[model samples]
Each structure stands twice: as structure tokens, then as C-alpha cells.
Target: MKTFQTVRGKLSGQILLWVLLAMSTTVYGQQSPITISGTITESGSGMPVAGASVFIENTSFGAVSDFDGNYSLNAQLENKDYTLIASYLGFTTQRITISITGDDLEKDIVLAEDLLSLDEVVVTGTGTGANRRSLGNAVASVKSKDLTNNGATQVDQAIAGKVSGALVQQNSGDPAGGISIRLRGASTISGSSDPLYIVDGIIISNSSNELIDLGGNSQNRLADLNPNDIDKIEIIKGAAAAAIYGSRASNGVVQIFTKKGKSGEPKFTFMTNVRLNELRKKIDYNTVPLAWEVATDRNNLATVEVERYDLQDAIFDTGFGLENYFSVNGGNEKTSYFLSASHLDNEGIVQNTDFKRYGFKANLTQKAFDWLDITGGFNYVRSISNDVPNGGINSAYGAITGFLFSDNSIDPTPDESGVYPVTSPLVARTNPMEAVDRFDFNQKTNRVITSIA
Candidate 1:
């Protein structure tokens, strides 16, 4: 009886100890994790600062504040005291010593204004510009140096391959040809897809008016504006631009800012440049001395010996271009003025094809009152071109068409009488030498643009 009582007492004590151990482990597993939470506010007005970053120093634990300036971080802290940091844009960063033990800690951080922070100013299609950091749309800006570095005389040529999602296409190989731009692909099938152009807040025409047809080739009026006079260019595309510019900006918007006078003594600048344009590749022509005889009946044809002539060298030549630009600018605290002039001459690869342009510009600004300023701008351009038919379908007088459709047996060199013989009688019915030498086509334009604000 004594042995049985001792065994029962020992078993009951062992069960009681195991029950206490399990209960202690359950309590430990149910304990909540430590968390650090805080609200970030401005120092002066105590306004909640959203999008602020709150983090623990030297650790990967961090969180961003919500719209209400509330933030929470789960910290598996190994140290007794940790350094909490809060940082925001245009605001001074704050750091404080924090302690996390067995309970959650609440911290409220105040960020002071960073007086030295300067945001970039960006043109947002509005009269008053906005900060670049605060804008949500994509806006690309190109400086004058970047636009003119590639020896470009025309504005379209200067912007080629410099902007994102902007495609520039030359319609013809003529020195004074038109350019087509597609900002967001073909937005409309029948309507014009060209982007709206604004120069110094004034809408300008970019139409390609062809007074005479040169095989469907025309000149864009935008070429009249010299690239040297540009200060910068801003491009805005997609729905963001349409909301501000309406249906006219369905394709995009291009804003050009001309150079303005600086507040200093008079400054003069002179620049001259020369460029060369050459053919990329030549077509491989068959130089064999044998060809199929031109028999009226194909079944009764015979091989005939002939002299194959190569006319590519005679049709194309190295092009030359020359440009001169001059400018003077000056201003005081109350008044400023800028004046510039430029001249350009370009020769095309085809013989007797050339382009010339003369441009002048003036900009003036006056401060009438402490809070008001008046500005005005004037621009003039004269363009002349010796054009040729180099584009579109098979026209008998087309420079390139006549050469491509001509026979290798027919020579393009003029005879002792200085008369060019027909090269393709059945097809183009014109000779390449005649088109390049005798065909005279001319185009001239005089335009003036003015703006006041």
C-alpha cells in the first residue's frame, strides 16, 4: 500500500510540471511583436508630410508615410536604443534616439524646410512655369548647343535623333525639302498628324505649300527659322499634352524659346561652319558586254554585243554647305535687347540643285513696373531654292526616276552639239543628263513672324 501511494504522488507531480511548461510556452508564442510607428509633420505649421521616408539607422527596416503622415515599421531590434531617421524632399532630415523593449513605441517627427533646395523650373504649357520635380507628365528639353552641334542648318535636322519617341523623316533628298514628324504614330488616318508648333507663345505655321509640283516634293516653312537663333526646345506628347492644348495637340506640342538678352554689357558672337554631304552607297550595275537583242518577237531573240555605260558618277556628286551666324545681346536692370542674323547656302548631291536662306531676329523686353514686364519679338527670313524632281512615282522629268529606269546601253553624256539624247524611250522618256543640266526649277519664299506679350 505504501509503494502504490508513493508512485501515484510522483506521477501526479510530473504531470503538473509538464502542464506548467506547456502553458508558459503558449503564452510566449502568443506575445505580440514590437512595432515602431510615427507621424511626420512640418516644423512651422505642423502640417502632415506625406511621402516622407521613416527608417531605422544602419538597418534595412523602413516605411513611407501615408497621406495622413502616418507610418509604421516592424523592427526586430537587436539593440536597446536605435536611431530613427525621417527624410523628405525639400525638407531637412530628422534623426532621433529611440528605445524599443517589450512594447510598441510612438514617435512624431518634425521636418524643417531646406532653404537651400532649388527645384528645376519647367515649362508646363502655362504662362507661369512649374517646378519639374512636381510635374507628372514627361517633358523633354533640348538646349541650343545640343540642337546645333551636328552642323544642322534647319530646325528639323537639328532635332533628329535627339528626342525620345519623336521620329523625323525627310521626304526628299533635295537640299530644301520637307520633313514629316510623328510623335505618337499616326493618330488620324485622314487628318493631319503634325504636332502643333508654338514659338515664344505664338502659334506659327508649319505647312508645306508647294507652289509648283517637283514630283510631289515640297518645302516645310519651319525651315525658315534658323537653328542658331533658338535658345531651347521643349516637347510634350500624349494625353497629358492634349488635356492642356485640346484637339490641336492630339499629335503633340513643340514649344520653341528664342534667345533673350542677359543683364550685362553688350556681347557679340560670330560663328561660321562648312559641311559636306556624300552619297552613302552606289548601286551595282552589270558591266557585261552582252545583252539580249531587242527583237520584236521574244522567241526569236539573239545575244547582241553592247557597250554598258555607268551613269551614277555622272548623276551624283559630293554636296557642299556653308553657314554664317552673328548675334549681339545686352540688357540693364530695366531693359534688355537681343539681335541676330544668319545666312546659309547648301548644294544638293544632284547637279544644279541648291538652297539659300537669310534670316534676321530681334527680341526686346522692358520692365514697366515692379510686378509687370512687356516683351516683343520679330523674325524675318528669305529662302531661295534651285529644286529638281527627285521624289514620287515615275515622272519622265524626275531626276532619280530617269536614272533608275534608263538602259545601260544608252549613254547620258552630251554630244559635240551639246544635246542630251533620250535614255529611256519607252519608260521615263527622259535623259538623266538633260534633267540635271537643262531642267530649271526654282522656288522662293519671304516670311515674317512677330509676337508681343
Candidate 2:
């Protein structure tokens, strides 16, 4: 019985020793996690590209480069062969075969510039993703150079006579007059004919809603935008382009993209503009007093000679405009920022009529994750105008209407008390000179547009 127990204990001890040896061998044979480190740089320039995405292809293991353009990624894999990818904006993506055989790897990647990136990207009303050549709808694009180089004070004026298959018409000769654009003709007979306007991915109000009764010559909301801040304008003029935004794009869509910072050192820009406006020509007034009085007198009776008065100088003057704009833009690969401020004071040909505007805009873009990017925009504008009524409705108090119906025989010079006498009974008891001087037609608008996407 003693020999049997001893044999069983020896067997148990041998089995335990073998198990311990196998466990130790297994633990020692395992390899460490594979780490891939690299620096991403631009081709030719050799500038370090921060915020670059570096990862193994078809795998979740990835890392974004730090500000120094250095990145490190770790992965535990059973396979020895894999593909590595490095990508950044405005540069061509690079992929190379990498073999990780139980050792850490160091590989530097250089990406070439993507020359076709600017031409291929399209800003549709829905969003910006697809290439321009891939779209089936007819889209008209106006770049910043075309829009801002026209000396236009208003955004609507910048695109005037520039877009194809669209009619841009000013509502009146008033300096702050509203603009009407008809894309695909009038959408509704009673409603607005203006197309929907989208700025920086936010649908904004381009309403011609008359805040005050300026005889339908009230400024449109599009005037609030600074023309110099516009980067691009895209118009989807076809109805078939509604695959993304549904019925809201019925009247066609106008997408406005503001300027953004480029990947480089900080750049500052300052612009000043001076403009002068004068009457093109005067109307042929009846200067012959004998012809006017003799032709009007039906009884062939001798009447008092009619005096001719040149009131054109009193009603019109050379308008002067001064504008100043300043902008600063800068960024690294990880983030980019743009800021701009502008002020404009534009006088009108009509006395006591002018438009003044103050504008500020800021845009920012940040790479939050390998697959995610965040962009934000803020725009603020305040406009003040000393407006004068001038439209086809012919309001009784309209400055132009009063001038039209007034008799030239009576002088419009103000009296000693600074009160103007009524010149004619035809103008609905409203004096043109008084309306131009003391009508107190003032309109002010403050608007702020913000977006995050």
C-alpha cells in the first residue's frame, strides 16, 4: 500500500512541473504590441503637416498628428502584412505597404499637393461633397474675384448682369433700394419671386419685407452681407437638383460661401474704395416760356410770362462714397481662422439720402477627429439709411412723385422761417423740397447669422 501511494504522488508532481514549464514558454513567446511612428510632411516644401490622419488601412487603429507633425499608432495583430495610410486636406492621400514582424516601425510620409482639388469641389445648395462635373443639374458659379472686383456695395449688386438665365432688377433708384431676382421666372404671382438664399450652410431670410413703408423700395436682407467677404456664389437653377433639400429649393437656390483661412502664416489685407456718382443726363425740359404759356392758354388771351427754374441742382448732387475693409486670416493644419471687419458710407444723388453699414465676420475650422471636422461661422451686420421713397406705386409722399407732378413755375426755395411753401396743387399737398429735407425717412437694420456644422 505504501508503494502505490508513492507512485501516485510522483505522477502528480511530474504533471504539475510540465504544466508550469508550458505556461512559462507560452508567456515568453508572445510579442509586444506593434507601434508605428512617423512624421507627415508636404512634398517639395517639406513643411510638417499637423492634424494629418495616420492609420492602418481597414483597421480602427489610428492617430492624428500633433502640432509637431509627429504621430504614433499601436496595434496588436496576428497578420504580419498591412497597409498604412496618411492623409491631409489639400494634399493627395498616400498609402504604402507596411510589414510589422514583431518590431516597432518608423516610416515618414510625404504627400503631394492636390492641384485638382479646387476645381473639382462644388458648392451646391444642398451641401459640398460631390465633384462639379458629376452633377447633372446646371449650376452657375461666381468666384470671389468676379463678385468683389465689380465695385458693388451690396451683395445683390455684385451679381447683377453676371449670372446667366437670371434677371436681377433693382426695385427703384433709391441708394438702399431692394433687389429682385427671378430664377425660373416668378414662382408665385402674389408671393415673392426671389430665390431661396443659403449662406454658409444656413438658410437665411432674403425677405423683401418692408419694415417701413418706403413705397416698396425698402432694402432687402441680402444687402446686409458684405460683398468682399463672399468667397463663392453657386446657383442651382434647375428643379432636378432637389435630391437633398426638398420643396424649399423649388424657386431655385442661391448658395453663398464666405471666405475661409488657408493653411499658412497669418495674412492681413486692407482695402479702401472711393466712388462718385452723378446724373447721367438731364431730361429735356420745356424752356420756351412763350410756347408753354401760349400753348396752354386756350382763350388766346395775353397772360403772365412763365418763369423757368432750374431745380435740378437743388434736387440732385454728386454722391460720394468711402469704404474701408480689413481682414486677417491664418492657420496651421490643425485649425484655421478668418476674421474681417468693414465699414461703408455711401451717399446718394438725392439730398439727405445715404446708406451706412458696419459688418463683421468670423469663420473657424477645426479637425476634431480622424473622421470628423467642425466648422463654425458668425456674421454680424448693422445698416442705417436715410431713405427716400421712389417706386412705381407713386405714393403721395414719394420724393420722385412729388417732383414729377410739381409745376416748374413756382420756386421751391424755403422762406425765412425755414418752412417751404407749397408749389403746386397737383402733388397731393406734399412739397418735394420739404420731403427731401425734413421727411425723416430713416431705416435701420441689425442682423446676425451664425452656423455650426
**Which model scores highest in lDDT?**
1
lDDT of 1 at 221: 86
- Candidate 1 lDDT for residue 269: 96
Residues 223-257, model 2: lDDT tens digits: 89998999888887887656656677777888888
Model 2 TM-score is 0.71
- Per-prediction TM-score to the true structure, in the order listed: 0.71, 0.71
The pairs that clash in candidate 2 are: none
Point out where model 1 deviates above 4 Å. Answer: 1-121, 130-136, 415-419
Per-residue accuracy of model 1 over 221-281 as CA lDDT, tens digit each: 8889998899888887656777777778878888898987755568899999997978889
Instruction: Report the error of model 2 at residue 58, Å.
Output: 40
